[model samples]
Target: MKKIIVLFSLALLSFSAQAQEIKWMSFSEAIAAQKKVAKPIFMDVYTDWCGPCKMLDRNTFSDPGVVSHINQNYYAVKFNAEGTEEINFNGKKFTNPNFDPNRKGRNAMHEFTGFLRVPGYPSMIVIDEKGSVKKTMVGYKTPEQLRADI
Candidate 1:
């Protein structure tokens, strides 16, 4: 009986260790998906050069609980704050007109990033099913903090 109990516990531990990943899509995709099935959108706005952003990706987002909760509850989207991707939102096309390909470290901020008015790196923008901005969380957050806030 003790051996059976140990096996069961180990199985449960392995199950919990198998982390689910957040299905991160583009902003446009997330918006389109809302029409089919209304779900809150969670956007992670990060810059390539941001240290905290990388830390958040490694520590918080990789957490099994965070990944599972985000996948099940929100339409997760990842938008690079300084990326060159052109995005269409609310009938307006936003682009990074000032982006320099030759630049080394930091590039120009994307138009949509400025439009969102993100205060700093690693901002998590939560939009409602109707595409209205709900909350903007700035800075790095732990898994527990993210779960509580979202």
Candidate 2:
């Protein structure tokens, strides 16, 4: 009985100590959430085939400080630059009409990505509560650097 209790306590402690992840929302969801709570949007624009984008997710974004800071201060959003999902931003509906499903690597950029004029993958776009772009950081950023930028 004592052994079972110890194992249960250990499992509970491990679960409580697990890493926290950012509560990522879609662009439209972030916009809607802004109306209710009025938080700036921290949009991560990435592509599936981008190496640096994956690195950002694994190294910087997974950091506890980065995750906490973003969740508390901003409405964290993850946008796929080459995805087919239609997004409505700035009173305009955007889509990747030219997206090739058969393509394995890089597909056509989403219309919203073009509208934002994103320089490349792993672009971190900060949008004000009013839905306007505040800052755009293009490239991989460490937790310290990202914390400083936001």
What number of clashing residue pairs does each candidate have, in the order they appear?
0, 0
lDDT of 1 by residue, 1-150 (tens): 999999999999887676456789998899889989999999999999999999999999989889989999999999999998889888899999999999999999999998999999999999998768999999999999999999
- In angstroms, the error of model 2 at 23 is 0.2
TM-score of 1: 0.88
Q: Candidate 2 — what's its lDDT?
A: 0.93
- How would you encode candidate 2's per-residue C-alpha lDDT over 32-141 as one tens digit per residue? 99989999999999999999999999999998899999999999999999998889877789999999999999999899998999998899999999878999999999
- Model 2: how far residue 137 lies from native, Å: 0.9
- On a 0 to 100 scale, what is the lDDT of residue 38 in model 1? 95
Q: Which lDDT values do the candidates have, in the order given?
A: 0.92, 0.93
Enumerate residue pairs that collide in model 2. none
Which ranges of candidate 2 are over 4 A from the true structure? 1-11
Give Cα distance to truth, residue 113, candidate 1, Å.
0.6
Query: Where does candidate 1 clash, by residue pair?
Result: none
- How many clashes show up in model 2? 0
